[model samples]
Target: MTETHATLPPGAPAFPPGRYGRRREPRRRRPLLTTLLVVALVAVMTLVSVRLYRQYGDPNYDAQVITYTGITDSQVLVDFRVNVPEGGSAVCLLRARDRDGAEVAREEVTVTARPDQRQVTTQHRLATTARPFIGEVVRCRPPA
Candidate 1:
């Protein structure tokens, strides 16, 4: 009896022999399947990133805020410059923030480049609900 149960420590409860099913071996690690899954996930992420970039990313239309002046309780004047393809037009997003960094106003301004010009300077009077602390040109993109 001691030889049959030699692996158990003294005072440890022992189950009757063959009372339960045999224990299973540990499952083997499938490195190839894991590698393939990782590769597929990366491919999917790459595809999504490329699609998003193509849809929204642009290098042709760039904008900069030259100055923001005439701030008041009601409105602000924002002067900005946009670079577009020669003779092309773009729409730029502008934003105004309060001292606490809350958005006070936002608007889209459209600019067109002349046949021989790539940069266009323009200004917009953005109406606001409260006093604007600063104005900014967020981005520019070709008109939809």
Candidate 2:
């Protein structure tokens, strides 16, 4: 009887040998730290944009006095005007206020006028005498 065995070449693996079938090291990341970094960047950008806009935006105007003439029971003929530049539209926000500055009634009107023009006029019916008339300039813009 003759016995035979399998043979391998020199310097080659023999299936029980070196460095084969090794598990690779896992990569590491800090999830909490990464999320905090993203949040900080967004907050910084928002503050910068708000500051820049306020520096370049237009000036603000508050509402002024109310003027009324030729009053009647149901309707009153009144001239509404706002102090604005040439080629601008005046917005009149009408409201009624008690002596304590509390709002009682409210309405809004817009008027466009050229330079060196007279007051803008609109007629409105009185809703309630319990509230005194309050008028304010809301906005002014060029004619489109």
Clashes of 2: 0
Encode model 1's per-residue lDDT on 12-116: one tens digit a residue.
667776766564698999999999999999999999999998667777887878999999998999999888999999988999999999999999888888899
Off by over 4 Å in 1: 1-39, 51-56
lDDT of each: 0.88, 0.51
Worst 10 residues of 2 by lDDT: 56-65
lDDT, candidate 1, at 107: 93
Best by lDDT: 1
Model 1 earns a TM-score of 0.68
How big is the positional error of residue 101 in model 1, measured in Å on the Cα after superposition? Answer: 1.1
What digit string (tens of lDDT, one per residue) describes model 2 on residues 19-115? Answer: 4565349879899999999999999999998887654433332224456544433333344555455455655556555456765556566665576
Model 2 residue runs over 4 Å out of place are 1-57, 60-63, 66-81, 115-126, 133-144
**Steric overlap count per candidate:** 0, 0
Question: TM-scores of all models?
Answer: 0.68, 0.37
| Residue 105 lDDT in candidate 2 | 52
As a whole number from 0 to 100, the lDDT of residue 131 in candidate 1 is: 95
